[model samples]
Target: MTDDVLLVHGGTPISGEIRVRGAKNLVPKAMVAALLGSAPSRLRNVPDIRDVRVVRGLLQLHGVTVHSGEEPGELVMDPSRVERANVTDIDAHAGSSRIPILLCGPLLHRLGHAFIPGLGGCDIGGRPVDFHFDVLRKFGATIDKREDGQYLTAPQRLRGCKIQLPYPSVGSTEQVLLTAVLAEGVTELSNAAVEPEIEDLICVLQKMGAIISVDTDRTIRVTGVDRLNGYTHRALPDRLEAASWASAALATGGSVYVRGASQREMMTFLNTFRKVGGEFEVDEDGIRFWHPGGPLKAIALETDVHPGFQTDWQQPLVVALTQASGLSIVHETVYESRLGFTSALNQMGGHIQLYRECLGGTPCRFGQRNFLHSAVVSGPTKLEAADLVIPDLRGGFSYLIAALAAQGTSRVHGIDLINRGYENFEEKLVSLGARVERPSAS
Candidate 1:
């Protein structure tokens, strides 16, 4: 494997404008939802990322014709000729993404049986596929585990049933939504994840003639439909990407105008940014975030499912918190090993301490599980450049932020991994006046 590396010259503020497209989280799922339709679906505002490419390849392997639309970032997917793919071709995508698990539902509906290869994603925590299989099993699908992968067969029509997730897992909720939409009866799901991306998927499905309802108590009810048609809808802006840029601006003491960033979806993050002495202005086009000229204040924060500080936003913001004046406490409730990335920050001259006990407002599932999910960040320390390696998507971006804010140049390895989520990130960084360049192959 070719490991792509970037040389980053530090101490430069990232000041400029960049545009964010459809959410990385929502776009891929929307692409998968097209398999449930009888006709072609048009998805606008799609970001060109590795995950999208992975899904597109998988869809094409299933005989779905995917082509670019007239407009930029638009995808036209026709699933009328969907067919079973070669097992070896399907296994080639194994360990590349977790999207294959989602294909089981739509594939099971179209074809009698579906084969799922080994799934892989960011090594953040234990994101088990048990929630997915359990929901499928409740819908009357039989799964057989083999050495290569899991094979699922639907002898009869799938019937929707009631399900309550142990946690508000975004993936499991999506599984329930995708499977329940085509089942025989109504599916009532409690303790569901109500993230904006999930709601957007629901909207996409609704446009495709599916009946779904959401309640204030995190409950969702979906009545299965016999048939679904194609949908033409523009996806929501990527709030997670917007927040990453916002955090980059705050960390480097610069200003950035993120076009296509919606304030409604990022209200919680904006509030937390202001609390940390970051300035922002929201208008019709997008939101402009900058570090106000002052010592950044420290605050306590926690990660929760929807309407709370997002776990994805925690890593980049932690880089900014390292520049704050005092102690900043962060509790990561979503992923157990999410805070482990801070050790690299400590290597870069930031003082951050990890703890097993919850350090923020609420105690979480990881509190008593011996997981180091909490952090104490002491800031106002001068950050110096160090040799850094990209960990995961969010953690990799955090390392970039740290490198840009530090005093000297740093070499960042495995930067190709960032393309899985962020689209054209290196170009965007350069546009923001960040001194980043790929070293010539020696």
Candidate 2:
């Protein structure tokens, strides 16, 4: 049942409002950055999700003092007691998320060693750590892969240097941030992923006294600082999670108000939502999106790193796209085999077909390989509840929305998969008036 999820009966249009918690993209790294700070750092508006719990466990294993802060989603980590790290418990986090790899640089700098468990994210592509290792090598860390996990060590003083990435990977870029902050000299990162999460993480580091700057394009420049003090920061709310809920509104023909969601961070998604006949209002607290009337329109969507249509939004939007009047073209450029999951959607009475050749009018990962890069969803398809398996993070949310929009109850296993990125999701569902409940696996 590692990947099984259970979603209950279909419901009418979800009304009322739901608030989002802190960003999953920023919290763990902010916690890791606390080690560089000399004082206790307070993180406000933290989510009580599983990934945050895992990071807290990792920080505790490393001898940091962590506990609830003043606010509801607040977390405080004092790394003053952090001397050495015992990575034995890291195995439990292996296959949980891609975040543990980001701990390597911080651990290596603080304790001269690091043990990284395996990583798991969306099963969309081969998310490799080659760039992470390469950047660490730029800082003079020796990396060795063992049967169980990865062992990293640094002999000399940690020094920063120039490095380039083949792709703009969010996790890899974060690795650079963690390692470079306390490093000896200046580090310039090229081809970096410029997601809003990255911007927020940098803001947290700056509050902790790290001299970092983002130049034109996707390059980041970080000048090494000897020490960083703890800081009090409230992370940005989860943009992807907000988009997921908005997609649920479209899929179920309902309405949802995402409190604390940011419109600037997700402008492209919001534009697409409006284009698909969805309506939303930008307010001080959050954004609201709803399906106006009739079937949605088939539009071309491509997954990019940031400042473009997000890859994380692809699967969830697909459910809404199924209601479009014509064939919707989705080009997954970030992850290669993201199309593989659509076959399961097709099994649910949807008219979705996959293509290995780039069908979105662009050359993609599948152009040369066997990877399916495109999906053609026929319009106004009715989804029937089926036994659903949680493949990954975004896919899991897609299934949840699909199940709620369907006419009948859906027994979806792997409910815990929502914990990876979303905060207080069940409560949010309840607030949105969803008829959801947990049951033992059948």
Candidate 3:
């Protein structure tokens, strides 16, 4: 695939309707869960994103059959012929995504061993794999850090145990869920991440004959079964993507109707958006997001885990906040390096200042640390077109939004990185009347 460039003619509002598929965070993990099943799993509403393709490749490497169903965006995964894959091929995928770490549990159950290559994701923070190995060790898996990658071997059947997270890491929680579902005994997890995607994964597992329960609090109980069959389930919509487009609409002074967006998953974001002077209408099919014909209001915001405002939603919304009437503060409590993207925004004529001290919300892990995870935006600043580089997934989309909201033209490099999360983003942008052009190959 070519690393293409997008020349965007700015100052035009992106208005129209675009539909969202399954949650990118959830669908790939659910596909990995199919390895625990004795039969084939049919997953509906699967998006054709790079992350999903990477997971599907990893799955096929482990001898699972991955193919599409009759309907569009449907994947039929069959794991009957489970086998080990070549480590070199696995290493090749390591640089593409961090998803190979998630294959550990399912591979352990099927082959009694697994190899995880050097993980790669957005350069947002230190996303260590220690939580994964620590959880695996508790379940009787022997871990060794080799020169190439981390290797694991399960001497016996994994036995469930009570585990509590030091912090509610989403990946660690998923590692526990996928491992606990087929372990020898009942596993109880406290301080688990109850994100909607996690809950959807649990629903898929339940459909596959695994018994799991979630409480009002952040506690989950899983009763391991000797065997699990395949499941047929539809995935939840991508709230992150939905909110990204909503922020785009707000930033560009436009309107967008995102089909398949769920009201329940985005309640917190919706309330926050309304507070920031955005308007929306929700119905059975989807939601319509628009700017209310006035300067957007500046509001204090904080990024947290699920049930709080999402960290992914913060980046795009910050672009809209650049057009807000007054000062807006955002304290990022998730990734330590997430605020690094603000420098590019500043280069594009947005006034955003980074600070080490947590300013707007309660002190988080990054508070007082050297990392500049907090930002204050003095908005109603006119954005000017500048050559932009795609930072991370969310940050890249935020740049696109900023470009669209700016005057004149902007050249965006590394447009391909957006494919990891957003599906057919260029096509979607074109559908919404975005004046973007991709240079042809010489």
Global lDDT of each candidate: 0.94, 0.83, 0.93
Worst 10 residues of 2 by lDDT: 1-10
Expressed as tens digits, the lDDT of each residue in 325-412 for candidate 2 is 9888888988887766676677777898887777765435557887778788898888787888778788888888888887788877
State each model's C-alpha RMSD to the native. Answer: 0.9, 1.9, 1.2
TM-score-better candidate, 1 vs 2:
1
After TM-score superposition, the amount by which residue 201's alpha carbon in candidate 3 deviates from its true location, in angstroms, is: 0.4
- Please name the candidate that would achieve the greatest TM-score relative to the true structure: 1
User: Comparing candidate 2 with candidate 3, which one achieves the higher lDDT?
Assistant: 3
> Where is model 1 poorest over a 10-residue stretch in terms of lDDT?
1-10
Q: Residues 172-218, candidate 3, lDDT per residue (tens digit)?
A: 99999999999999999999998999999999999999999898879
Global fold similarity of model 2 (TM-score): 0.96
The TM-scores, one per candidate, come to 0.99, 0.96, 0.98
Cα deviation of 66, candidate 3, in Å:
0.9
Task: Evaluate candidate 3 by giving its C-alpha RMSD to the native, one decimal.
Answer: 1.2
Task: Give me the displacement of residue 22 in model 1, in angstroms.
Answer: 0.2
Candidate 1 lDDT over residue span 72-145, tens digit each: 99999999999999999999999989999999999999997899989988999999997799889999999999
Off by over 4 Å in 3: 1-3, 440-442
The candidate that wins on lDDT is 1
Backbone clashes, candidate 1 = 0
